[model samples]
Target: MLTWIALTALLLFSLATYMAGRRRAVAVTAGKPAQLHSLPGYYGSYAALWAGVPAALLILLFAMFGGRLEAGLLRVDPPAAVQELTAPQQDVFYDDARAIARGGTPSETIYDGALKTALEDKAAKSQQISSLIQYGSIGLGAILALAGVFIAYPRISPQFRARNKVEGWVAGLFVVCSVTAILTTAGIIASLVWESWRFFQAVPVHEFLLGTEWNPQIAMRADQFAGAGAFGAVPLFVGTFLIMLIAMMVAAPIGLFSAIYLSEYASPWTRSVVKPLLEILAGVPTVVYGFFAALTVGPLFRSFFNWIGAQLAGGSFDGLAQYLMQVQNQMALVAGAVMGIMLIPFVSSLSDDIINAVPQSLRDGSLAMGATRSETVKKVVLPAALPGIMAALLLAVSRAVGETMIVTMAAGLQARMTLNPLDTVTTVTVQIVTLLTGDQEFDSPKTLSAFGLGLTLFAVTLMLNIVALRIVRKYREQYD
Candidate 1:
């Protein structure tokens, strides 16, 4: 409800801002030397941005960190048992506490906790104090806005330069929004890094990095070799690569070809019809794809393999054929293929844009040199757009690597050191999801291992992006 309210306010604020700024711009330059300082639309945009951007940002910050701040102000010790609860369990604690305060459940531990009691008290106090802050903030903001409007309201005054002022405000707002997003990303990375460091302290960095097997099972007794537990991230990473490879194999060709067909071959009418239809594929929830892969696709692949084995054995039962079939029902191939299909729009849309953005002059030049359409496209347009195309592919690969829902639902969660695309293999994303999903102790190795996996995945993607950028830069230099 709050979210809806905030969003609606943002939209209304934006519209009002545009109108006010546009009107002000027109009024400020009613006549004389600086006739029409800027496009009225730009002035309107400035007002809209100024009116909504800061408040929207404040709302977002409050949503993300307000609870943490409120929690901090309470100064009560977090329940040790509650601290051990899994991520989902921790959310339940918050929910139950809210419910308790609202007179829902008396039996809940959240209703009984010292921390909860303190928070409830603090929440009341904070609400009282916040009424003052909220009014002050909004009052101050409105005053500033009115002052801006009053200054810009005058008609053709010598000092009036509404356009410049409005643009400056717009530019400032843009910078602030960009900084907020960047800072949020940085904060996330910092948190992940800190947690990963803690995990590395518990498990040896060398063992985690260089060890060959990744059996995280803790030993119940002393002197058990298998119980020693291997943390070789190699297998998980290999599994990730295999899945990505399969996904790319399916997505790259399909997406790229689709892009070509849309950008070059299709009429504008056809493109209008096809583009949205393809993008609809992107909108399909990944969880749904997961089920499709797991239930429908997995079984079909298993059946096909069984039929092939039967056919290979001439419809006779053969012991040798059974030995040949080692892959599980949820083959990596099925998951990868589905994931690739999911990524088709991602790659194709990006590729299409880059291809279209390629200079017409290049194609015309190639054609003037007696090149055919395909030849011109291949030799001139593709080369010109290759950097962006590579960037798009790299982005798609990153998405494929980080994708979770499809893999969690479809891909087998088993982490094995195998290159077989037909075998059920786990991915880093699936492992992290499963590890963090349940009702377990946070301090347990099982939970913390998710952080390690996240860090590793982050590092891999970061490196891939860096390498992709470097490659794009190098390719760009060839043309320059």
Candidate 2:
């Protein structure tokens, strides 16, 4: 809070300096605009940047590293009893002391010896040291800010190109932002790959990819009876794709047809009202869609299939009713159907924008060649927009593959492969969530397997995106 107050004061001072610099620039002009090198506003901005930028950067650095610096400064040789405690025990002791010093009541067992006295003393010293560091850092920031103004004020003359300097700083800032994003992505992938390597060391990679079984429940002890767990991932891949296929079957035609009507055929009033209502599905939370799937769509499908099964009982397939009765509310079909409903807005909005981007000249040319409006739409406009539609569908597919809540709520987590959508199944995402929900150590394969699944999912999604981009490019060239 003190740092914030100091920074706010610095900002207000920078603004004042900016106004002073602008007035100085005007004074240097001396009733002649030609005497100035840059605009008054540009000079003002340059002065503000000089007055605040270095100090703001210093404050940011202090915020990030101040805790570590204080921790180092507060370190004192512990008593023999405290030194004998394990590392985690020491951490707990320090945590309690810090909390108590901050006015929190201690609930744990009292130390009751020299250890308690030592902790209280340490806490008091930490508080005193922390306050000194905070105030000192603010003073240092003020000094640096004043130094920056002294260095910058002299260069704010008529001959100095303030605009070029400001633009150079802006360019450097942009480069820093870009590099930060690139490095962040690299770090994420590297972490996933490293942890996945550890997982594969314990479980064979080939079995994980190919074998039929997927029992991730490992025996906690060798004598515990559950076999050395199987990690075969085929069932998960199959189920993921199966649900995704069902979703596309429902979403593709409906979303595409809606996009076409809205883009080409709908009246202005109808499009304005209907488009927002349709896009509202996109804004509806995924958890609500999950509930809709589990509570509403699941039962409707169960009832429909049960009736069909009853019909099949009197027919040649007399034993099918017993099988269909097993089809319950929680299955891949229910999840996929509801997921398709959730995906419609993504498809519609993207496809509508892409269709609108198709050149009016192409439609006009097709019509001039004696083509009907429907013929022009089918042949010229659609072909032109097909690449973008395919890209949208691929994005929707990626979304479906990554979805968890709807699948968890609507599809029971039975790791078995079945072509029948009525059968229970689980996806990679659902299993990853299940595996990593609790506090578990990375020493066990069960916890590390989540990272393995994440890497595999990332690789598969990357390949899918690459293939989609290739197909889009191939068609785009033909259209061009």
Candidate 3:
């Protein structure tokens, strides 16, 4: 609360400095605006950035690290009661103190005797320390903001290049954002690698990659009946690709054809009306798609298959009929079909834009050469837009591969290696969710296996991106 108040005060001060700086620029120019190196707004923005950025950084820094600082200070001289407790108990003690200091309820564990006394004492001290940190940070931020104003307000003269300085600051901000993104990606890859390494220490990588069984449940004791866990990932990979293939089979032609019609054939008014209506499918929540698959599409497909099976019961196709009649609600077909519906807008919108971006001169030239509209579209437009179309398809593939809710709801969580779309199967993402759902011990292979799966999925997605990028680049060069 105090940090927010300080930030608000600093923002108002920055606005005031902006107005003052603009006026100063005009004043220094002796009422001649053209004498200034940059516009009055640039001068104002320069002063505002100076007045806000430093103090905002300080406040944000305090907000990020103040708790850790407070905890370090509190733990410098521990109570005898706190020191007597176990490591976990000591953690709980501090947690309870912090919660009590913040006027929130602590854990259910009742504190009694010296522990209770220590908790109350520590809570009071924690409150005092928190107040001190908050007040100190706000005061320092105010000082820095004032200092910034004093330093920047004097430099708003006509000869000063305020525009260049402001742009430099903007460039620095962009660099910081880029560096932050790179660092974040590095951090994620590092964590995945580390955890996967730990998992491989428990289970060999060859077995995880090549072994057929994927039972990750390990026995609690050495003598328990449940055999050692299997961590074969091939079934998961098969299921993931099977669903992705099914989804692409459904989505690719329909979405591409829709894009072609909208871009080339539809009138402007029709395009405007139908495009948004089609894109609305993109905005529909995946959970809703899952529900549609579970309640509507699954039952419909099942009944249709069952009806066909019943019709063929007395014929030569009786064996195939039995298989069709036994089909369940939860199958790869249900999840993939619904997921394809979800991806149509993504493919159509991107492909439509790409198709429209093909030069009108190409179409005109082809028409002048006696080619029909469809022939022009096929030979000229599609080839020109092929790279972008490939990119769109890759994005849709990524979306399909990463989907979990639709798969979990519509497709059963059985990691079986099968080519038939009617069979129940689970993907890598679904199993990752299942493995990490509840309270899990990270030391165990089951929990750590999630990271291994994540690493493998990341690798496969990266490879796909690389292959797609190469294809896009090859076609793009030809077209260009």
Assess each prediction's global lDDT (C-alpha) against the native: 0.73, 0.84, 0.89
Per-residue C-alpha lDDT of model 1 across residues 1-480, encoded as one tens digit per residue: 555465576668678767866766666656443465556666666566656666666666655665566544433455565566687766666555544444566344533566566446544555544444445445554555555444434433435454686668768869999999999999999989888887776677777776668766543343432333566667788888999999999999999989988988899999999999999998999999998998898888878777667666633556645633544577689889999999999999989987887767788888899999899878888778888788889989998999998888777878888888777788889888877775655565556777999998999899878977886677657545
Model 3 local distance difference test score = 0.89
The better-scoring model by TM-score among 1 and 2 is 2
Off by over 4 Å in 3: 78-100, 103-123, 218-229, 383-388, 477-480
What digit string (tens of lDDT, one per residue) describes model 2 on residues 1-480? 888998899999899889987887788878664677778777877888888999888887888898777777766677677787788888777776666767876558578688888788878877887787788888888998888788877777788888888888899899999999999999999999999998888888987788788887653764443235478888988888888888888888899999999999999999999999998889999899999999999999999988888878767786787788668998999999889988999889989988987889899999999999899999999988988899889988988898888998998888888878999889998889888887656667777778988999998788778877786677657545
Off by over 4 Å in 1: 1-175, 218-227, 314-320, 323-327, 469-480
Error of 1 at 46 (Å): 14
How many residue pairs of model 1 clash at the backbone?
0
Candidate topping TM-score:
2
Sort the candidates on TM-score, descending order: 2, 3, 1
Off by over 4 Å in 2: 76-101, 105-117, 218-229, 469-480
Task: Output the TM-score of candidate 2.
Answer: 0.89
Per-prediction count of colliding residue pairs?
A: 0, 0, 0
- Which pairs in model 3 have colliding backbones? none
